[model samples]
Target: MRRVLKITLVSVAGAALALNTAACGGKKSSSGDSGGGDGKKSIKVGLAFDIGGRGDQSFNDSAAAGLDKVKKDLNVTTEEISAKPDEPDADKESRLRLLAGKGYKAIIGVGFAYTNAVVKVAKDFPDTKFLVVDADQCTVSGSNVEGACFSEEQGSYLVGAAAALKSKTGTIGFIGGVNTPLIQKFEAGYVAGAKAAKPGIKVLPAKYLTQPPNFDGFKNPALGNEAAKGQLDAGADVIYHAAGGAGIGVIKTVGGAGKWAIGVDSDQYNQPAVSSVKDHILTSMVKRVDTSVFDFVKAVADGSFQAGVKKYDLSNDGVSYATTGGFVDDVKAKLDQYKADIVSGKIKVPTKPGA
Candidate 1:
């Protein structure tokens, strides 16, 4: 079996780590140290974005939502390093080093592309707290670095069920950015969910790119569009995509064809761009990157940035279902039941593919 280590992107441009200290708003600190407030120390958060940046409408944008929340609630601002997977790792390391040198207390690297970067930087900057999302547990345990991962399978399962129920036709489709474990994280859960909801549901699954890990796949909509069209031509009525930017293309194609689509990460129905497809959206697998990022920032602030692998399961509201489309009411009821089952331990959806 090939172990696919799917690396995600850093984040989008709109994400910042600036703290919103209301009382300290522009008030000069008596201590003469800028950023340090009258009551709290100024905390800087660095966000290293993935290749797709903020517009991917899936993974990267979801992560940005969390960082935005932290900035609004915690009074901590952030800086971003937008790097594609194809970019040299050494260059990214230098960028991380620069942010650390500038006195950022907490640094967040959003995807697997920064897996080695975070590991290396964590070793060098023992003082800076680090957080990595969509990550595999690396060696060199540190109280400073925290891994924020999601039970994508849980959310994927709900949408999978939704896709199964809503597909006017019996066939469904799945398009992903990479062919790695992380992508599999979404794939495994979706297939299982579809099967659980509608036994013997026909599923069409395809990876956008065939390379070892095409992080760019997440940034490409054209490729996703073409792939989705192929599925639709094959009789799939509902398509679910975890392909980040590529997923956007999926939504567009589905909307253009007057078919249905399943969104991921954030609620695609709510996005202005996807407004045209709002009606066609079956449901979305809410991967709560926003909550996870906000909580991680708070952890660093409260001195609770614990090291090691910390998984976000369904029970903790880490992953959930969102369907604002026409079928939301029906989908919501079903999702609620599924949620109950998952919380009550009656359901245990596998996170890996072919499980």
Candidate 2:
């Protein structure tokens, strides 16, 4: 049985991290030192982001929300660095090294792409505690590294059911940022849930914007738009996208066509970039990267930092289906029941497509 944890979303003013635009390399950003004169040292945290950092209004933004909470409640000083599209692993290693060398005691690599880099850098700075989101920490040899992993498939399942229930054309579509094993989890749960909700529903073949070693799929809005158009043209009236920043294009295209679009990572219904198409968003598979990030930082600050994989799933409220725009209001009861069933282990969501 999975351990259940309750998480509350905290909203605080001035929670946004201030980026130093003048920083030349790596687009590095830092928050002002919040150490007070009361003889207590403020905890310094380093956050390394994946592609489409911060304002992508999706994955990175979800991580940013956690950092923002840390700043507001923990009074922690922080630094942020983002990855470039298709950048080499060396760059990621350098970014980790730079943060560790700067004496940032708690460093977080915002995506699984930093798995190798985090492991490599953890060996060099054993005193610094490191957490990588989406990667299993148990596989690491370093004693100071931990991982924040989420059961994204669980949340995706709920939204998939929603898409199937609301889809008028009885044909739904899925778009992945990259054809990685991680993204495949979303595809798996979605297809399974859609079929479970409405047997014999027509699901379009999953489309991937890019493949490995080329992560441009996560950041390319044009590619997302193009993929969405293809699905829509093929008679898919409901589309779910786990395409990170590129998901904006999916929302735009799908909504423009007056079809339903399901968002991933963050709630797209409230995102300003997709405000014009907010009504078209049926729901979002809300993966609480923010909660995991905040929990990791809080653990480090409170000296409770443990080096191991910490998994978040539906049972813990770490991932959920968003009901923004009230578009799914009519089906909320059914969605909640499915969520309960998943939590009780009555239904097991698949981590791989067609499994």
Candidate 3:
């Protein structure tokens, strides 16, 4: 059965928090032909960041990384509108339209949360190329738009297994920004991973909001700590936080607890989480969002843009398991085989619950 992608379409500002900053590059656009310019097509690429803004160490950062690469490699100038967790859909949609009107050749929305906003913008601005990460194909598959989906579970499974192997307790937890298909993919893979390590491993889940559209759900570290503590109290020894900035709490809560947490999207092992937890960070499930974003920009610049769903996974080098934390060294041999199995179709990863 095909599952519909239920997404949160809007965000509003809530508590404000500070995080480190990183940016991607692009060139300014002119009234000349849309090929940027004659030489390199001096096109302006616009990116609207997800609620966590710059340093959620997850999707936003990943997208920025890709944009940074494209900006340098393709040499295009870029601009971005950083969304507050509470930024309204109307406000964001206007920004998208303005960016398009400003002669931006491509405008990228970094998360599925932008689905409601981007869909309308893409339709109105058919002349401009639009790309949205993790969007529902039923809603946003236009001739001018592209959806970049990922095999999150396939990669998350490996990291989940690594966390299980590194844990003393047979319990792990998952923290998500919202209980949507994308985050559900993370939760399901985590459960599968814990099971693969040792069947019957307990998995805990934490959701920040009681309702949907709370994109700030990813920006709350205090709630994350509370959730992590709840899991720890229940005897969870490791946690894989897919909760964006909320992950900071997981790191802070795990301090000296003799347990660990896996960071998602980026290598959180080298971040403040690791600085606080030492070697407690097991690994991160990386979605090279930045690579894909920049790839799209470069594609348009080269006049080779592909519309519709473009899947990114371990096979495409779009998504992969990163063990930069050294916590997975003991299981490298096993992981190598797992990677092979996924690549060769020997192992089938699930996209939904009970799948």
Candidate 4:
């Protein structure tokens, strides 16, 4: 049984931490500063969060979960920086520089927006290891920058299969937060998976909350609701969204319309913010950002830190479809078979739709 994804479940415990205390800029604070008797020096890891920050209950929060695990299990100290919506690239650069400037051994940028900043900053701080999540665009060429990218399409494929399998109307919908290569990965995988499950299944045209240069799409639930309503009105009984916080609206609309919704990044079924509509959430395309984040920090702490691109995929347990709601139980065996085939390379999940 060769593992496809590197699945390591880390438990996150504690209040959410962020470095956005100041109105105009980022802030940094220490957690678990208590002394350790082992006499091994503690390492400082800094996280620069994406738009929704620590409490978005999605992507950024998943990264925070990894940080919390390090704080509890490894006894490491950490600091977090939250990103403001539509902030300039310079601000992102400054945040990354700040973390590296503060003597932190490893500084992590939580989203693809940090791609440019990580590439530019890592050149100056050669001693500091930089990790970027979701930004494979960041060049690791001759620099100390490592990207922790996930096979989002592979995970989306599973959920798409679930959506097709579970849809009673023979139609499904997908909503993306922003129009980018990354989000497109989610769209492509989902559509492919859906069709694979049920040939000739009608997939509605994918909708975007916003395009690039306007990332409010990731944070705006109003937009998500509107997009979802459009889908439901078009006869889509099941919708899957990779819209971050905005996806909350999708879930709400699905529940209100008596349809089904699939979540992203983190498990929406476990989130209190979406509790009211939990029953409507069929499952989540769980992208384990925490595992990647934790692995980087842990490697540095263990004196085995390396700089390069590390990918998580179905083959490595880096991505999968969640089953917390148990709505997919009937299709679990079939989904598991698909998972096995993908892991065995018999099925190659497409990163681009129709590819």
Candidate 5:
């Protein structure tokens, strides 16, 4: 038998109230107490989502799936909170504090933006374990903190190859949510993979929706739409976006134009928000955030938690390309061969653009 967990969607204001309620003893959990009849300890887990949160149908949703799996497979109680667009670091700190103060034994922060906040808060709540996705624990060390990161470039490479193989115009495009090193990795791999598949491929200059400190790029569909239109008008027949929620606009615009659009993080073809344009989705560069999150929580529950970074890559099935619409079926063999070359060290994907 399993317990059902109710996850609430609360605004930043509502989160403050939830924090206040927790301070007044709303819910409580003891450290590693075996409560369930099955001898498994029932723990309280808190998830701090990235911008666009659970319904973005992309990155945050992938993390939410892991939390959902934790709820189904383990004896645990859960709470989730999301970040606002362009929110300050203080807000992230506060969210982590809120979860720690609520007595959550394990807290997971869903994006790289939480790096500083996770480092700061984990210090105050040494008893509570913290995991920040897309962050490197080695760089931001904390005794109680761990990181879940992925080789996004490796996955992006596969989709870029797919786009190159399918493109009839010999031109493709890459759109990033923010102009950051992380997003650049996606561009680098896409370009490298496209060029690898076809030596004469023409890739347009990368476009970014926003720069640092204005992360709204991740949640702004309008920006994505504008960028996609520009690329399409410039003769790009296939477009790939690493733009989180904003990718919805990319899909819509590309689909409306009957061109191919590749997705990131989650399989957009099956994403309900983009169901109407599923046919236009070429494939997605699937990064397994869900597996990493579940593994982190499970480690804490089993008292095997380690404070360090864990990297998920092609060899571990942590990153790969999706084939949801069967759009890439004809090119699957070539893509797999590329994947094998990458895994076998015969090919090394670039992590920076123009590298």
Candidate 6:
């Protein structure tokens, strides 16, 4: 519930008024314009999603949940656009610019991949607020772009501890979508947590599905499966992935191996798409993207939208480890103690791998 200020203004006549507005040139509200027929304020928010958008049952879907919640609770109009594989940076700028040009009050770029696009597009439209979910690249010293960054390493550490405590083989594996600092945070935190739980725990060599300038790693389930199988064959009994949609393949592979798999971004165990193999998912590193998105919308609506970095961490409910299958119940006490240490500054999880 970080910065979540919900203002309830029921749009009883919203449909007809929206129709009339469209009929009358569709001029978007600028600087808090309250031009509705019933004297209520109206605002438009837009979201640009990364690969595996909307129904991947992971990252994109979490952001979609936020958008849906804001539309329902605040009665604001919304728009969403998904990304194409290997789309150029210019294409990202174009998509973001389209939303800005259409008069969206707040436009959010859903992944770190949109850092460049958000940086370039926000400068031209000073009046509109922009948010980048994963990367803080756009929120430089004087930029008017806000960043909704998460302490992923902190959450990853918790799940890593679970994997360590649950490992019967004394070895676990982590699969990342890309070989970038962001994904590396997952590896770093997971490894740190595992070591913290078991001083001699052996983490198999971490693997990435792809490298930079090629983000299909986040979407390609086949590659995830390939990477995971390699780790599992190496005697790793518990596997964790920060590979976005690709993590689905990691989970499936773990299921087939009759081992444990940790999910990311959402409570993946409850996801309908993964129901068939849900039992294999031991836990998920809940990223709270929905909470962040909803908070951003509320900020815009309240006219308190600031351009800077806002971090969601263990202390703020921004990140945590989920226990959907009760597989981690035996280790819950240990994990809780570790979480308490993190929150109380007694433990500082590394953000960069090998740090």
Candidate 5 residue lDDT tens string, 172-235:
9999999988899999999999999998999999999999888978999999999999999999
TM-score of 1: 0.86
Sort by lDDT, top down from the best: 5, 2, 4, 6, 1, 3
Error of 4 at 119 (Å): 1.6
Give per-model TM-scores. 0.86, 0.92, 0.85, 0.93, 0.90, 0.88
Judge candidate 2 against the unseen true structure and give its global Cα lDDT, from 0 to 1.
0.85
lDDT winner, 3 or 4 = 4
Each candidate: RMSD to true structure?
7.2, 6.3, 7.4, 6.4, 6.0, 7.1
Candidate 6: residue 169 lDDT (0-100): 95
- Model 4 over residues 152-179: C-alpha lDDT tens digits? 9889989999999999999999999999
**What tens digits encode model 6's per-residue C-alpha lDDT throughout 1-355?**
1111111121323221111121212332212223446555678888887887777789988887787677666747776667777778877897788789988888988998888789888999988888889875324422568888888999999999999989999999999998988888889999999999998889998999998878888988899999989999999989999998898889888888788889999999998766777888989999999998999889888888777889899999899999778989889999999999999999999988788
Better of 2 and 3 by TM-score: 2
lDDT for every model? 0.74, 0.85, 0.72, 0.84, 0.86, 0.82
lDDT of 4 at 143: 57
lDDT of 3 by residue, 135-233 (tens): 753246678888888888888878877777777777777777666777878777777866787776777654443246665557788877888788889
Model 4, global lDDT: 0.84
lDDT winner between candidates 2 and 3: 2
> Which 10 residues in a row give candidate 1 its minimum summed lDDT?
23-32
Better structure of 1 and 5 per lDDT: 5
Model 4 residue runs over 4 Å out of place are 1-13, 17-20, 24-26, 33-35
Candidate 1 residue lDDT tens string, 1-355: 2211122222233323322223212211111123345576568887777776665677778877886666656656566555645667775686678778878888888777677788789888999988778776323256677777788888888888888877778999888877877878788889988899899799975554545544667777888788888999999998888887778888989878989888888888887777887888877888887776788889888877788777787889888888565676766688778878878879898868788
Candidate 1 Cα errors over 4 Å, as ranges: 1-38, 137-140
**Comparing candidate 2 with candidate 4, which one achieves the higher TM-score?**
4
